[model samples]
Target chain A: MIDNTLNRRQFLKSSVGVAAVAVAPGILLYGMANGSSEGASAKVRWGMLIDTSHCAEGCNDCVTACNKENGLSGGVAATDSQWIRKIEIKEIAGGRQLSLPMMCQHCENPPCVDVCPTTASFKRADGIVLVDKHRCIGCRYCMMACPYKARSFVHEALHDQNPDVPRGKGTVESCTMCVHRVDQGLQPACADACANKAILFGNLNDPDSEIAKKIRTVASVQVRADLRLNPGVRYQGL
Target chain B: MYIHSAVLFRNRLFYALVALAGIVVLAGLYSVHLMEEHGHIITGMNNQIVWGIPHVFAIFLIVAASGVLNVSSIGSVFNKHAYKARAPLAGLLSIAMLGGGLTVLMLDLGRPDRLLVAATNFNPTSVFAWNIVLYSGMFGAVAVYLWTMMEGRMKPWSKPAGFFVFIWRFILTTGTGVIFSFLVARQAYGTAILPPMFIVISFAWGLAVFHIVQSAIYAWTNKVLDDYVQKRMKNLLGVFVIAALYFVVAYHLTNLYFARQSDFERFILSDGGIYPMLLWAGYVLIGNVLPLALIYLPGFGKSYHVNLASVLIILGGFSLLYVFIIGGQAFPLSIFPGFEVKSTFGDGAISLYYPSAPEILLGLGGVAVAFLITAVGIRMLDFVPHEDTKKFH
Candidate 1:
């Protein structure tokens, strides 16, 4: 109304200084969001634990299944917009060479959420960071924000999408952890395809579930754990 | 339009641009064609380097576009005449730069038909989302600035628009750097210098575009560039070369300083490495440091050599970025330590990313679109200040 653009520039002219003054209140809100002051007192805190040892050679079943279920084009194109991919980690010197399936580790303190100007892919009450495809402008910042190369962009439309695979164009997407199927009491596409039954699926909060059991029994790892994302997917032997 | 104005084309520069533009466009077209015919499968980009050339070029173009404001902002904000004449051209070029960048990027996409979705469906947290807004906003800002400048109305909005556009342009470039820098898990971590590097690349590429476009405008209009303005543009170019060189060194050295990512670092810098000789020879020496030296040396001030340095500076900056985007994605997460994966790093990746035949044709069509738009813009809007811009012809 009152030339906000110009007024905004004035504020921005001293932006660094403004940032300093803004930090205190910003930190306050941040701490609350991070569940630091309230420690384990947030609503629906979703987490992950990946058993890396389970992600073995030629075992890109999760990746393949995710692609098929997601209706992603499996082609020799320069980019596939992979929602999840199997990462082969030759851990420096013979640290039990590992192949772990990496996905959108749905971070608790999601940087993807932090940088989004529109608040489209906000962290929900249940803590699974997701994109509302309807609201998505498809800028791919989430792709950049994700430490794991998890999100994929729907750069174009499919001629005939596989009826089984969930597909869309003009928006970015990722391992919704099969949010659609999860809502209907179905396991994720990957967990369904895993032959070794290596892929464990269950609520992390449920103390006796197989996912929780594996986490407790085996030494598991999460990618970039230092970032304090408290990932839902934990890995074993990674 | 005076057809008899003095400083028109004399042999080298214009012809060279025509050649460069023609070659780049042809290459882009051919590559896109290759991608389309064979599918993007031809591109060296696997899931690892999902964003190889297009991402880098897109960022490069955006950064260059952002820096196009340097001359104008300094002139308007600081009120220096040194770069004032070049401002309008800079503004227009930023628009062309955006178009070019977008064209290259669209060609890189798996399904370019959905480009409209970038504006329609929104992932608010996605930088790609914000970039859509930022780029659109920048295009608008630059478009208006050009209008106001051309119409002789340096209104209150004009100054702020100019200033903010300059500021946002840098932010836009920094946002691009953040796109890469934010990837903490990617081996590219430990280098926080991306934002600054984007700025330097922005300045270097911006000035290069500025110089080239200035030559074009002069060639077309048959107008002589005032010696004073040439000197100023040359000075700004010199400054950009130096800053780019400094930041390039700082960024790489900072990463090399950290022992944690050292192996990944060496893989990118040493012989048999994807980035190896390119980093030292092409990027560091030729792209940055050497060009910086050539421009800064006392004898070369304001000469054709300065323009030569600017050209090399742009190519070097572009090549370095190509190395980062392509070469960065060359090897696997070298968590494998002591194993040879593959050498399809730089030269090989370009070929690997060979776009299908239809893709190449469409890419050429897109480049045609960019050039056509620029030509139309030049004809319609007065991209140059009239002789009376300084209040006297």
Candidate 2:
């Protein structure tokens, strides 16, 4: 009897009220449970600080960890996929030898993102550069544009890929800064695996973070800083 | 009855040539299929040497395609009667070479099937994206230009169409050169000179291609190119070759002056194994100098020498591109300016690339596609040059 003569306006208003009440709590809870559901936030800028002084010359734990985390083949052939590698460098005049892990520096002004014709190479708001493989045509222009040579083209068909880290042949790929782990409020595989604690991962924007505090006090440098790409990755004791 | 039989025999030969080209194209397609199935792992291209022999072939054709239009531009835009007569043939060659060049480039991609994605998704900032627009726009412009030239009613529009193409080719060639120039990281390519250098190089290469094709057509039809026309075209080719050589020299000298780029210059000019050889012996002596001599040197300007020069010029074009595209990449990036770096990824070391069978086949297929198009187009259309005898005399 209460709604026996209800008008269209009254009926619509009641339906809206009921639906909002029903859905609001679930939406709020979901947002609370998965903060990244709204996508990467600009408030956070993820970065890495590598202290080469602490790094051992022969240690390849970081590379191994990255390979496992990313489901890479761990092959070092010119055609094989190498997401990360251990580079040994000697100063021409100083003769100082240093070993460091090299991968995508995740530049704020990434050349790969710039040269990518399809916008397949992009940067997340949190400063992680990633390849949207769904849109990638595998032209490798991004690879040529990359100064670090950090990117690799998938030369062959991949099998048993990590479900979390999706990859395939005919797409360019590089370090995602362990984006999956970083999104879940976890350390990158390389940082977590470093035995000597040489790799430090944190939010560069958060002045309170350890990496921010350390970088403020230490003399760290970005590779190819002259190019003015302003990469998030920094090295100490180079 | 004898004349009828001769015409019938000529028709048969044409069909046979078309069939041979078709077979080669099929083989090329099969190679592409295999490459797609196996991925780029089967090709000689790797992480270090990202572009290879296929790129050399593709770039040469694309550049020459733009250059071939110069003939039509001179005729229709400049209102030269001799060139106007030959405009249709030039137009045909431009379309043919462009088709061939783009085919090789598309097939060499890691995901040629995703051509749709490339067409739809464009990053406005990328020079490569701009090139996509430029390349497609070229085909459209050239097609309309050709239509205006061939159709009797559209004849009045030919001048305007030719004018548009003249401007468009310059922009198009600039786009091609900018593809390399925008790579700020590469030692071999970041300079502004590359665009102009490419434009001039295209002039020489394009005219050389036109000469070869024109000669072949003349021979087939039993028509001799008028002596005056031959002399004029050969002189133009000589001038272009010299101009191209000047640009090349200027580019090298500029690179040699930069302290950072000096090592790269030394590597290309003297040190790098095959690169230096290709530059000096192949490009300089054969592609540029020898062709110049054939055109300019007394008694060397005969039909035989001119034709031989054209062939050598084409060969030299391949050699130069090989050094430019592959050799450019062979030199390692200077990631750390003052460091000697070593990595499993071939950092600080010269990357090795050996062109595989499938790669060569795929490249040759592009050439066949171009050849097939030209043969059929000439047979179907009035593309053969008909010089105005009264004006020439």
Candidate 3:
């Protein structure tokens, strides 16, 4: 008798090892697919460079596009959700006029994130500041702390929300930098809508990206740079 | 031997007061329901002016609540015999007022139902997070402090409890001031002096509240508060009110000196419509100056005049908060320096705010809740002291 017990134990160990080896590759591939968006790495910091000089005085293409894309064209006047808006600024001394779209700067050191009690206002690994609506108590302390005044409180009940951009009543919201498009490897709506090539969007950290190349060639200014928030959004010819 | 104090539940006056408070609280609850159902659009607050009258009331109650405990702290911690008798009432008022303030703050949330989120998921860096812990901690500390004072066997524990409370209240008020002080965005609030300033104002406001309640209790029980006790407390209040004014002046002067902050200073001191009037006439003249003169003046040392000063101080407290909370927001954020900017959003313009009825009701409801708690507490326990001149001396 050739020790039947020994033979059975060896058979069981060999079978278990073979099963794991066969199944492991499939599980690893699934995990990789879920983790990477078409192999887009999080090492790339997304940013925007706007040439205000190229921007037209009255053209609201970017604003309208953002509204349409974000489902904010509703009649919530005085309490309207304005994710991005064109601001007209004139120098008091020189009578020089400048127009630029203002939105969340997507700061590396966001004061809104700092003041939020529930950590509802948070920055993603990729540097996009977002409000977690489920967690926000809507105390508006973040609004007070934000130097740019980029955030808005949802003042009324919202219906007919865009399936792509989810929003609701009793929560604070602001520009998500069209994060859905970004995840899918596409430009933001505002950048896509710019007829005069005023808005440029791309990966800031990538040395070969168009935005980084342009920023290297020309001077760009971040609004309220004195605060040293290290804004992802930069303006040319302000 | 100790003389046991009697509870005051049988008075018809007590019943009437409790009933009135109950109605106010109900009204406040109804308003919260309406705001929750219809949304914040029903209120005067817009996106620009986020915090409104509710904040003014809430902050005042919170600061005053901390200050109210000073009497007990002085008695128990510092060994002042005169204040020992008053310690129990002081502890009661502090807890009640703090509860009232927290209630308003909770009801004002966009999703009051999600209070669990705030309690559980906290940002350690945020002053508000610290406040939640401080405020919740305060209730437990103050309740035990009150217990230590009330029970004969627990008398030995009172001093340590009072010491803990004194230190805690200081930190609590400091955190409250830090909520604004830490804001780098606001030109009006960036200062190290804010915490100390809040402490002084808390003292004045808290003492004023204590005086009003004390007088009412004495009147109700057909007893007299010793003249020496009245004189000492009122005189101390006068000093605190003046110190508060001095801090206000120093704060403004500091702002006025900075070129970047000059416009904001101007807006608050002179040009801004309601702010200037409230700051000068309401807070400085009526609240501080007139009261200071009354307390220090010879003939005005009587209980009637002292009470009048106390009432004015309380009113002045409202004015000061109105200026601090609303006025701070009214002056627009300096988004772009040296540039005149205009947008669909109210930029380069002072955002308008008018307090609505629902907001007022909610604030009053907080006050009513505080008063109701105090009334119930005194009715059930020996919170009020049996003050005899001989015993105190």
Strongest candidate by lDDT: 2
Q: Evaluate every candidate with DockQ and list the scores.
A: 0.13, 0.66, 0.58
In candidate 1, what are the lDDT values of residues B169-200, reduced to their tens digit?
A: 87788777777776655566425788888787
The TM-score between candidate 2 and the true structure equals 0.94
**Chain A TM-score of each model, in the order shown?**
0.74, 0.85, 0.83
lDDT order, best first, reads 2, 3, 1
C-alpha-based local distance difference test score of model 3 = 0.86
- Order by TM-score, highest first: 2, 3, 1
- For model 3, name the residue pairs that clash: none
- What order do candidates take by DockQ, descending? 2, 3, 1
lDDT of 1 at B391: 33
Using lDDT as the yardstick, the better of models 1 and 2 is 2
> Least accurate stretch of 10 residues (summed lDDT) in model 3 chain B?
B1-10
lDDT of 1 by residue, A1-238 (tens): 2463345335434423333323453232222223222222232244556655555666778777877787766553435566766655554355545566667887777776765545656776556778766555444555545665566666455567655444565556777777665544356788888877667765564443456667778787776777687777776665
Best model number under DockQ: 2
Residue-wise C-alpha lDDT for candidate 2, range B1-393, written one tens digit per residue: 248888889889988999999998998899899989999999999999998877888899999999989999999988888788888898899999999999999999998999899889999988889988998899999999999988999999999999999999999999999989989899998889999999999988999999999999998898999888888888888888889889999999999999999999999999999999999999999998888889888878987789999999999999999999999999999998989999999999999999998888889899999999999899899999988878865
**C-alpha lDDT values of all predictions:** 0.63, 0.88, 0.86
- Candidate 2 residue-wise lDDT, A91-161, digit = tens: 99979999999999999999999999999999998788999999898989999999999999999988999
Best by TM-score: 2
Candidate 1 chain A lowest-lDDT run of ten: A28-37
